[model samples]
Target: MRTLHWFRNDLRLQDNPALLAACQQGEVLPVFILDTDEPVRSALGGASRAWLHQSLTALDASLNNNLVMLKGSAQTLIPDLCARYQIEAVTWNRGYEPWTIQRDSGLKAALKANGLSVTSYNGALLFEPWDTVKKDGYPYRVYTPFYKHCMANLATRTPGVLNTARIQMVPHGEQAGLESLALRPKVAWDEAMLMDWTPGEQGAQGRLQHFLATGMGDYREGRDFPAKRSVSGLSAHLHFGEISPHQILASVRAESPADDNQTHFIKELVWREFSYNLLYHFPTLQEKNLQAKFDHFPWETDETFLKAWQTGQTGYPIVDAGMRELRQTGSMHNRVRMIVASFLIKNLKLHWHHGERWFWDCLVDADLASNSASWQWCAGSGADAAPYFRIFNPITQGQRFDPDGAYTRRYVPELKRMPSKYLYEPWACPVEISRAAGVVIGKDYPAPIVEVKASREAALAAFSEMKRRAES
Candidate 1:
């Protein structure tokens, strides 16, 4: 019997249950569909597209150049390929995003109706959304209880190791290759991202090894500081299925099972699972506010402020640094992500979706579930979100997180010579100090776009008004 292995988010060959299962049955035809036109899932943004191009290239090479690449909707293409190749079964790993789950369900039903066996395995997440639930069968909404439950019942089952020796590849049908998909950007602005990442399984493994050796020891103390080399930087790799969460967890458990840092890393992995769970239970997560009261919250939609925020010209060092880093590297530190998000939603009084959309376009690790959930968390519009009145002070956030001006200096070069006292708030510098630093507040670097004290007060007043309106 011939089987077709459909690769979606689970892009790698190792530790992939569906790919492994397909290989075991009979001759396996490995295929990937570039569903650029799918209405259910939004089109891949430029950074994601660039990463996809590289990832697909690496995947094809790993398959001995036999991976069949096709472009179109998976619904019609899978059946057409089966008909053409006389495929006996179709197998793939599952996806948790609302549209993908719906698409997979319809495809499974259609294939089964035609007498073709369909198998969907969990390859992306450590546990499927439905695996862990409350006694009444509903999913947990709060992170603390949800994480505790997951930790208590955490399975030690490691990801399956693929037997490459037994693998056999089927000849390509309706031949195409990675370049045919046109995933790369037409104008070419990815030099920094190219320097920063290697988008494949090998790169993911290398990142894990480096983190364990150097970064994991101080992950707890240093993760909040953007200048420190404390983060895993494996987000894009994880998002593209280059690395499995189980593999990451197992690696940590083996090296430092008793260490607090290792435990914290595991909690972060569990957080990823938690976001997927939220999206699974609340299918409208990306489209609507999870907290209904937030539906009445007023949002100022100003393009000028939005553009300034996007371009890293917000006149706030920490905010600008994070935005500039995102544009150049296609990723940003976790702590910076929160600070910048707070500035956008609360300080500027913009809707969370605007920032969410911008990140969706700019971030290489822009996951639908995490991006939406985090934005809502900042906007106080999510389940278990931070309160709306808890506005972040951009100046202090920079001072606290990027102390000594190292992070701000690296990304916002104009502030390279500014003193630590005025690094985050250059407008506070006296004329002599600004001159000595070879920087002018309004000329060389922008003054603070919105004053921190006044903006915080305005944001609180707006929040109060939103509550009043919602109650009325």
Candidate 2:
């Protein structure tokens, strides 16, 4: 009996449910397909492909340097590989995004048409998204009760590992070359973003070890502050499935019997799970608003505002800095992400979908679940979205999350020498003071494109009218 373990998003060898299940069947043929159907590489960026190539290269090496990397839509290529290799059964972890759901379903049918057996496992999330629902079995709309139900209802678990020694190695297909697959590599990208971070199964284990040893203790307080190295930085690893949420949750649970930080971090991981649930239940969310009322909610379709936001030219230091960080590194701090996204949707009155689409293109950490859920949350449109009227004042947001302005200065070099007091709202600096500080408004940097106070009031008024209309 021979089984092929199809690596969709889950890339790691440890605590991988699908890979383990494949081991139980026979010689595990681990494979990763370069999915072209995904829009990120084609439309807005090359940075993701560069990152993915590196990640896959790293994985190929760790699996005794024997990973089958292929291209040409998984919808077609998967069945071809199965027939050529004479695969008896195909096993893989499940994917939840609507497009993936459809694509995987089609691939499964095609494989079955060829008289192949299929097995799928849940390695993506600690809990399946749709499994945890209300007594009425309806999908969760709000996060609190959803979270409460997850905590109270789900059974306790510790992480499990895949023991390769327990498996019979497949001697055939051992000579397949990765480069023969023609997976593209190396684009003009920020080397620092890829170099500064870790990748692959080995890197994931190292990160889990270090976080549990040094970072997890203070993660609760440190996660919100950008200047603090508090976040686990496991996002891209999670995105590529190099690390499983089960491994993370199990490790956190093992370290402290009752640490609140461990629990908080686990809940955040569950937040990832909840996001996947939303995507699974409401497949239309990727393109359409979950709340249909937003379809008629007049949105200011300003490409200029979007350009300013995307290129870090909005003149609000924190928002610009966050945008710049994402442009340069393809990632952003969680808190800053919210503030910057809110600025686009609420302050700029730009459509939330616009920001979501851009993030989908840029963020290597971008999960369809987290990305869609968060953007909708900011726009007050999807399940558990923030209230429509509550707008983020960019200056106040900077002062609050990035109190010392350490993060803003790192990405916004134009404001590197500016005083911390004005760092968050440098457009407020007088021209004379700015010139003396060698900060020329139009030359060194741009002025605030929109007045913050005026924008907030306008956003609130629009929300108020929309609310009244929705209520009516």
Candidate 3:
């Protein structure tokens, strides 16, 4: 019997469930499609596209002689490939986005009509979003209990790791040759992006090793600091499913088992699972607020203000630095993400959707679950969101998270010469210090677009009105 392993987000040969199953079941042809209609590629920015190319290259190397690259949607391409190759079954790890659901469902129907067997597995997330549920059989909206449930009852299933030496079932593979398939990215690959990130399965494994050996123990303390390479720089890999959560969990369980850091790291992964579950259950959370009361609150649609925020000229050093980092590297520190998101949604009263879309385009690891939930969380319109009145003080946030302002210095080079106090709010520096930094307030780096004290008051009043109406 012939089998096809259709690769999607899951890009690894090691610990890959679908690939392992395909190997075990029969002769296997491994394939990936450069679908122009794929949401990831269609919206992928410079960094993401570059990373995708590298990851595909790595996957091809790992598979040795067994992989093929294809173009066209799997819905259209796979059935034809299956028919042409005389394949009996097509299998893959599932995808989660709303758009992906429509794509996969159509592919399943098409393959079935072509008289081929179609099977899929949950390998993308540690816990498939739908499987985790409250005791009452409903999905949990708040994160803590949801996290607790996930942590308390995470499945012990091991990821399918390939021992290529044990390959007794190598395929007499049939594929539309690479030239005919036309599977290259449309975006020009950015060499700078490649410098900042390592892509693919081996890269993911190396990152996890570094994190466990040096960073994982201090991850809680160091993850908040963008200046330090404290957090595992594996988000892009995880986003693309190069490393499964199960592999991460199993490795942690095997090595550190019962250590507080392992426990903490596991919970963070669970939080990611919870975010997925929240997205799965509340599919409209991307476009509509999870908290319906937020629906009544008005938001500004000011393009000028948004353009400043996007370009990192918002005049708030921390927010600007975070945005600048994103512009340069296609990723931002997690803490700063909250600070800037809150600055836009609450301080400036801009619609969360605008910032969300920009991040969607900019971040290499831009996850639908995390990005969507995080924006709404800051906006106080999502599950377990910050309270409406709990607006971030950009100056205080800069002082707290980036106490020495090293991260600020890296991205906002204009502030590198200023003192630590001035670094957090460089505009507060004397004219002489600003001059020393070669920054002329409004010219070099723009002055604060909105005064923090005034903006805080304005946001508080808006939120207060929202609460009053809700209470009434």
Candidate 3 regions with alpha-carbon error over 4 angstroms: 36-46, 155-157, 165-189, 467-472
Error of 3 at 447 (Å): 0.6
lDDT rank, highest first?
Answer: 1, 3, 2
- lDDT for model 2, on a 0 to 1 scale? 0.80
For residues 418-441, could you state the per-residue lDDT of candidate 2 as single tens digits?
888778767678777777778988
Model 2 lDDT-worst window of ten: 40-49
lDDT of each: 0.87, 0.80, 0.80
Q: Please report the candidate that would top lDDT against the real structure.
A: 1
**Measured by TM-score, how close is model 3 to the native structure?**
0.92
Between candidates 1 and 3, the one scoring higher on TM-score is 1
CA-RMSD of model 1? 1.2
TM-score for all models, in order of appearance: 0.98, 0.93, 0.92
Q: Where is model 1 poorest over a 10-residue stretch in terms of lDDT?
A: 36-45
Give model 2's TM-score versus the native structure.
Answer: 0.93
Q: Over the stretch 232-349, how does candidate 3's per-residue lDDT look in tens digits?
A: 7778899888899888888877766476667677777887887888888888767889998887776777888888999999899999999988877878888889899889988899
Better of 1 and 3 by lDDT: 1
